[model samples]
Target chain A: MLTQRQVRLAWLLVLPTLLVVVLVAGYPLAQVFYWSLFRADIAFVEPPEFLGFKNYLYLLQDPDFRQALWNTVKFTVFSVSLETLLGLAIALVIHSNFKGRGLVRTAILIPWAIPTVVSAKMWQWMLHDVYGVINILGVKLGILSQKVAFLARPELVLPAIIAVDVWKTTPFMALLLLAGLQLIPEELYEAASIDGATRWQQFWTITLPLLTPALVVALIFRTLDALRVFDVIFVMSGVNPATRTLAVYNRQTLIDFQDLGYGSAISVAILVLIFLFVVAYMRTLGREALR
Target chain B: MRTWLRLGNRLLFYLLVVFVVVYSVFPFYWAVISSFKPSDALFASDPNFLPLPFTLDHYKNVFLQANFGRNLLNSVVVAGGATLLSLVLGVLAAYALGRLPFPPRNAVLYLVLAMTMFPQISVLGGLFMLLRQAGLFNTHMGLILSYLLFTLPFTVWVLVGYFKGLPRELEEAAYVDGATPLQTLVRIMLPLTGPGLVTTGLLAFIAAWNEYLFALTFTVGDKVKTVPPAIASFGGATPFEIPWGSIMAASVVVTVPLVVLVLIFQQRIVAGLTAGAVKG
Candidate 1:
């Protein structure tokens, strides 16, 4: 399994990728870690002062960071769960006999393919209070007595954002699950039906078990993406703590507020949280995803 | 009773299908129609659902008036450059990892995948500092370099599976012809990677094009700005005005080509996506 020539060849091939990754990923990661120790406020006319553990200590008590953490968890949990359920339903439906199946699949990719910024902006226009179509449609359809501002209110912001996310990403989840659905043999379903196993029973005992790997992988990907949510929320509500995510709050601190060290600390906190999620998933889910 | 049940099931299935299509396509349709409408019509209490009496003023504003075309060009350059570089590096790494018995091979693969999971925020400050120090703060090259974080890992992860999927007999024949591993890869396996290249390259281009935060953070001037940030920053002449028409037009302009590409390559894209996830 171990050959010197093979190892040399592989390194020769992989050298450039390794080099770029170290520069773009590894070095920046190290720099963030290093800066987490200092108080690097760019707004002041002073050099960064080393203040080990202080930024992190303050971060532990930071109200904004806490709110962001809560918001991220809420967005991640709600959006991922909804996307999974809807994605699963769509996959199952389209997996079986359906007219225009290819057309339906292609139709769904439109939402997923539209740029996130465009999605946010388009929805922003639609969710406008006075002249927006969503409000207009809601009133006309008797879903609402009057127009409602979807993005401005604290109560509705996360839900509005989740709806937008689900719209954009459910197709993606459906595609992944559909791929998993295709992997299971038709014979299994045929034999089960012959054995008098109802479709529901077949789904529970066979489909669900076989789909767990794809489902788990999809969850991990979406969770990581949701955990780092930005553009959509940022575009809809600019730095509003009502919907500020981990990345948003970090951007506010680091870029907007110019608290580089404190921002780096926030960045490290986010890094660790995601790191923990990956590690935990690898531990419990048994790394079927890696295969 | 059985006939009634079958009829109801068909009706429900068709109903679900309609809902899915409308839900997915309606907003995009709305965006297109809105882009064509005049400002006065847009502000009316009851909106026109159709693009009647359409005006091209918004498109005029986006092209003739603003620097959107330049921004689009910047996006094309950056996305194109990053995709080309990523495909080259990814192909190299994938071939080596898929074929060779290398030490730390598995570790490298894990590392490549791990980069995607890294909190991009963790690297933002450092990347900013590095770019500024290198005098590449607002350059397309810098944007392309920084985009390795997103594009490279994806290409490598997807292409690894593509490389692995190739039959071993080809490689053995190349070896029997006294070809070195590199020659076998360059001459034989490389030629067969046409489809894999197209899929990964298109996906990478799309990823680079859609990126916002990094572009927003890195570039400060209009010359190097891309569509997402450029569109985000579009506004009316006054603080009270939002220029909804212009924003919608810009959105439509940048979105149509991508939507077409995705529709055309939907099958390959699905293959690429599942390979990234399920095949590792």
Candidate 2:
């Protein structure tokens, strides 16, 4: 049933995209795998020496690598979970019929729209231990006896970074959930109310089950973004290892230390980790979400 | 009892609305106000939340002292160039994938999705080498070329949804008229998908404008560096001395234009964003 001309036209149009993708992504990714096997440093004069899986072997034993991995997972899990709960609350509230609803919806986009670096910089100033408004307000309200160095403290830095990520991303999650909320028919709610169901019962019985598809998609999307978080933490955390996620750590290895082979190995590890995440997500959520 | 319960629910609803608005809007508000505060007032003991004793020195300093004008120009060129390139390539690809009933359509789409999710850090070494070899390292075009990795996926995916939503009759009519595929796309479909193009273009521009990782790695000199890196590199006279007010001014200046544009095209942008995930 297919015409040869149509197929040819399709390939012609799609070929450019494939070419660009392969040049920028696919081939570079292959190059990364190749580079991962050699001990190459940008600073060195000699050609790279092949080490096979030695870089990966050292990576397994490297505590810094493990810490960065832990930091990435912690940030992703905590931030995404917080964003989900807060995003759900926001979606429910914004979905309600109210005056100024449109303004509230647009206002929430401010955080999401601003560049990540700008948001991080804004918080960097606000989290200042001495002159910060957060501490000023806290001291005024008697919540703290003195100012706490938010970014400098090892224990608090990751949480502080997570707070920034949550602040920036919750709006995005809310919008997706809001779209899902709109898809639920009003007649179902009306019928439930007419059947003597309480508000809580209606929500538990009607809203959540219907919203699962949207929720799953939103979770996966946010998880994918969070797993590669860089800008907010990089701009805010200064030189703290406590806040160094996988992307930030990888940048350090590739650009700062100039250890090309080790850095490429880390890159390979990250891809494998992300690939596993996508596979697990598919297995659990089923392919219906993709469609 | 029922009246009290109803009153409680009403109060809770209003409270939640207030919390949401305040939580989301307060940071930008703080940034705007802080940008105008004098250095003395910025670090005052009882800091003035209002823009009292306002000063334009921060804005003046951001441009005069920081060489930020050059960075702004660089951002405009890079983001603008990337947006235009992505739109061109994206429209062609979107036309094929969305309408043409091509073999391997599903595979190509998934390939695009995977690329969209491809970690930039993974490709940092490879891209660095490629850019250097092309003699484009530390140049605007390099950033634009690398940006294709993110912007292309977004424009194609969103425009695919837009193209698919169009009626098949239009294309068929063009075919009946003996129009070439390019002619039909240019003469018939392009006019109809104007809003899609604008929405996708604006989103891509904002993305490239805001990108930090590629921009940071690809460019070094202020002659080539974009706003994000320029702003990140800001420091005071001494290591301990931080220019909080100047950084805020840069943030507000960079953000206000985007916020205004987003406000104007909110609906289209929202539709474009959800069209991908919901349809997928």
Candidate 3:
């Protein structure tokens, strides 16, 4: 614990990795922060002017940015809640002793394994106005009077993107919860059973309490990821700045519009939000997951 | 009365299982079957569940003309290179953190794990500026380095668990036998954590292989493009006329490797997926 030589050796070993991380991650992070305060043009920059807080102030007044904030929050809350419930239900069902449980567990992972772009495209085709299977089934089953343009209608677009997200991510949630479920000692359940406890009572007393850590971890991960949603919305709704979340909008500002200062400010805001989530997660995870 | 209740429970469980499977697997099956049918038949009023008059024209076009193969190759090179590099670097970092007692060791670990949660959006602006300046923009090298943002953290986290699970005495014994630290690591510790190595490597590969956002933003030319963006907007060239058959064929081709891996190592896949959640 106290040898200088040992410490030196350890540092030497870690030096290369640290260098790579700094070069790859640290440098870019610093550059972005630097760029966010200047009038950096993509095409022509004779001498970039320093414009501190101007970009952020402009963004605050921007209607599109405000709408994006609201959309991100709405998407995260709805998607995370639904994914958790569905994940828990699926986990519980599979946790019980059943035939072909192995097969079922593997089947569940198919959605999570498929690349997000493929799944988003699949749903896009299914939600197409005229010939989508979803509309076909909806009309046949009398769910809708006529074909609905799921991606076209502004009202339905967000929900449609959320649906694709939920479809793709619920399996991931269920897999994590299933691992948590598997950890609870069978002895505790058996002991409760011998005490004449009903299944519902046993689950309340034993299962849910022990599952809190995993549930919180899953929720935090999913919610944080969802809040920065981009691909599904970008692919399905065509990144019109109306359906943009923080991520999609940030892309528009930097790449499409080349507003580096404004984009960096948005990025800074997102970084702060993520930092808050990590701290909250660390508190709930109680130092174990950190290990 | 107890037997009757048990019977009902069994029936309900089976029904639920059936429902989950159908809900999960139907779309994949739909994509596969639809890839074979012609476009006119796809929009038919009374649709047949199976592909009637099956054809290989879709696969033919996807391979012959769509340049999907080039995209697939680029993804393989980028994903494969990133995974390999991260595995080597991450393993070293993980080993040092796990074995060596250094100042701020715990702090470093926490920082790396926390970085895993940093949404890509937050860093995109900064990363773009830096990369463009460094001449890394619109290059495969840039994509690989950017992917390390997720892969390195993920690899280190998974390997921490693996390194912890390994017995210290084995490596201690090797060191006592006069082997150098590097020798002990390469010859002794690594071989023992074979399964962990495979699982971590596989997860890293999959994440990089499927990544869409960075690849989409960074790589403009087909020479450096990856599969996700290519497949995502396959119809953009001719917006009105979707090459549905070719798109489905490409999806199938891209998906087959992952599907096969799942079938072969289903248990390991499940274990790997939830590596962070459950532990002994």
Candidate 4:
């Protein structure tokens, strides 16, 4: 029920944002699609020659691209699952009546507030083979026979990166889940307790089901972020190949190797994968909500 | 038996709380302590939890030798400029979406959200080219423009939510008083959404400040580098040396302000984040 004048004013108001978005995001996105179809190398003294689908064809055979895709999937699955489980536990604990609850919440947010690169740098020093406190801690706790090169070892590097991601992002997940936990009416829990439900039963039947919406939202956000993770891997293990996610690999290809066409192909592939994930996730969540 | 079970549960809860606190706070604590330790003490055989005989050498090195001061200034300008630009554009768009019954409102909202989720790397190649063409590459303006890709969408989404929640009666009354939509927005709505503006603005500032990939890609020289890249590329006298103490000092310098702001606005930040995320 709006007048034409109001509608025109609305369009006028939204014009600036729309223009900025188009200039900054929309135009570049179209450019990415255009660039992906060529053989362009900025470092090479030659112009871009269109090679429709050739760049993507090469990507199909690129072992590094495959490995990066695998690494990204592995990182996303492991980190998001671990973060969710740990976040749930922490959220449940903090949701309860406790002394210093507010203080604990603020403390946990410190890690999230710290820039990712700084956290990665801090962990790099803490994981140093010789001078690291983690090694010293391991030895004292009887967990290790000697200092282990956590970031250098191929088997341990990805896990080490995952551990750092878990530490930095678990609090964010907990915060989101805690918000969801608060929305569950207290009377529901009270009624369950009055009906002779055990604590564990109440949790399984009440908390898990009621927290699904937040859980789904948090999972999607974390998964999307984890898929394109760059800062942690870049700062911690640059071009290591062992822990290179798609975003890091894409940067290496574009900036380091100057392979513009190939890099754009990778970027487009990532966008496609993420879009599909989001669509499928929203669809399933929509169905669940309907049920 | 019931009393015993209750006691055990209480003990476990306390232990879990302690673990959460220690895990979250200890890294920053250790970083601060390490920043104050002398080079020799840092590599000592025994790791000290506390900085015994604290030294300011690392801080001095960071400021005097490492060129971190310039980098900090760059981060402030880029992040601050981006925040201001996005807030202005976002408020107008959000006001439109929230107040006016515009056609395609949902489509516009979804478009903005989709832009936020798009992988930043996807745009790096194109954005780099665009910036170069516009003669903005390696400039603060380039980074600011690139950052709008994230900040604008986020600001619009959060502020839209805020504006929707504001009382409609105020705008109607203003309308009856012969106030235009723009006038109502500026004269009436802006005053009411003060807290929302602060929350959204702070979150946008934080995002731009912490941004890494674009800053790393867009800027090259020490003149234009931000804290993340500067800290990442920090080195010692030798190629093999890492200069951990100085790096920790720079980290402390870059992080302490953000931690203080986050602590002060913890409640509002949480509100804005959840409003943008969970509600959507």
Q: Compose the digit string of candidate 2's lDDT tens values, residues A82-152.
A: 99999999999989898999999998989989999999998888888898888889989999898999988
The clash numbers for all candidates, in the given order, read 0, 2, 1, 0
Candidate 2 residue spans exceeding 4 A from truth: A288-291
Q: What is the per-residue lDDT of model 1 for residues A138-157, given as tens digits with 9 covering 90 to 100?
A: 99999999889888789998
- Highest DockQ against the true fold, candidate: 4
How would you encode candidate 3's per-residue C-alpha lDDT over A101-159 as one tens digit per residue? 88888788888888888888888777878877889989999999999998888888888
Task: Name every residue pair that clashes in candidate 2.
Answer: A290-B280, A291-B280
Report the Cα lDDT for residue B53, model 4: 63
TM-score of chain B of each: 0.97, 0.97, 0.94, 0.98
lDDT of 2 by residue, B1-280 (tens): 9999989989988988999999998888999999999999998988887999989999999999988999999999999999999999999999999889699999999888887777788898889888888898998888899999899988898898889989999999998898888888999998999999999999899999999999888887798899998888789999989899999999999999999999999998788777766654
Q: Which residue pairs does candidate 3 place in steric collision?
A: A32-B126
Q: Model 1: residues >4 Å from true position, as ranges? A: A1-6, A42-44, A287-291
lDDT of 3 by residue, B1-280 (tens): 9999999988988999999998888888888887888777777876678999688888888888888999999999999999998999888888888776679898888777766776877677667766778899878898899899888888888888888888889878987897767787789889987888888888888889888889998888688999999998786356788877788889888888888877777777677768844431
lDDT of 4 by residue, A57-174 (tens): 9999999999999999999999999999999998998899989999899998998999999999999999999889999899889999999999999999999999999999999899
- Clash pairs, candidate 1, are none
Candidate 2, residue B70: Cα displacement in angstroms equals 0.7
Assess candidate 3 and give its lDDT: 0.82
C-alpha positional error of residue B28 in candidate 2 after TM-score superposition, expressed in Å = 0.9
TM-score of 2: 0.98
Instruction: Kindly indicate the candidate among 1 and 4 with the higher lDDT.
Output: 4
